[model samples]
Target: MPRLLSLALPALLAALLAGCSGLPSRSTKAEKSVYQGESFAAEETFSRLFDANVEDTCEAARRALLSQGYVISKAESGVVRGAKHFQPAGEVHVEIAFNIVCVGDGPKQQIATAYVSAQQDRYALKKSNQAASLGVSALGSISVPLSSSDDSLVKVASETIPAGEFYDRFFTLMQRMLRENTASR
Candidate 1:
């Protein structure tokens, strides 16, 4: 029994040590410094300093959202907020929120960053029934059955768009808005 126990312990220890190698190991100081050379998780900010003033930037942002069918909700204090609700299908509905904040003085220029967040929801049809009582029916006092349906939006998921392409497209559209807004005046 002692001999078998001694033989099995080493094999079990060896197998356990082998499993640890599969995990990521700590890097050496030099190797770690190499990785730190570049930023990995830095937030992608899409802000551009425009030649126009702050008020014009805000107006351009508002007009950009409006042109894209977004309903402007708030426009004050160098911040322009807009939202758009659109239906893609019979039951799927999506709402996108556009928040553009401008910073800097009106005399020189301003920089604005637009953030977009989207939420998707699906509507479900629910059927319900009700019993109604009628004092005087054609024949006698009777009861009637009624059916109704209602839709409720179920939010499945939501997230902030972290892609650069989306922000680039938005900024490009905003640029066009600024140009047009200035052109009109």
Candidate 2:
């Protein structure tokens, strides 16, 4: 009886833990997704090949982002990051981040490739109780700001934008930027 109880206890605990496992199940086919310049999917990539040097590629990306009304927040040696926010309807806001990275192709030192990844996040307005300080601290009670935050409508959805038309237009614009940059110099 004691041996059976011991084995049962461990089996029960193991079963509970397995039931709560957060790992993917065997039947689930997780698609490869890339966020920013990082690739979470080993088999998937959304990068376009640019035949320019790293510096020129990154600069072109920066200009392309700015042309589209994206705010350029960071520009570094081989990486450019930008974001844009807009509201299409009431109480709904959408944000997109553009992450571009330029690197040398493994087999070709002279050839550099620029990779672009866009991540999107959606948010919705929410209302919550707040204690407004009507000029007086109402019997020494502190007041909290009424509003300034919102809840994410969904988990941040990230995917590589490898659509032919989309990337073709994007690369064409980037090429124009690269040409302009060269001309300016």
Q: How accurate is candidate 1 locally (lDDT)?
A: 0.69
Specify the highest-TM-score model's number: 2
Could you tell me the lDDT of residue 62 within candidate 2?
94
lDDT of 2 by residue, 1-185 (tens): 99999999999999999887967876675665445555467445557667677888888999999999999999998999999998888877789888888897646555578887777777776655444443346667666555444344553345445445766677789989988998898
lDDT of each: 0.69, 0.77
The digit string of per-residue lDDT tens for model 1 on 81-142 reads: 88888787776777777767777644434544343433333443344555555465777876
The lowest-lDDT stretch of 10 consecutive residues in candidate 1 is 117-126
Clashes of each: 0, 0
Off by over 4 Å in 1: 1-43, 105-146
True-vs-predicted CA distance for residue 120, candidate 1, Å:
5.9
**Residue 109 of candidate 1: its Cα lDDT?**
44
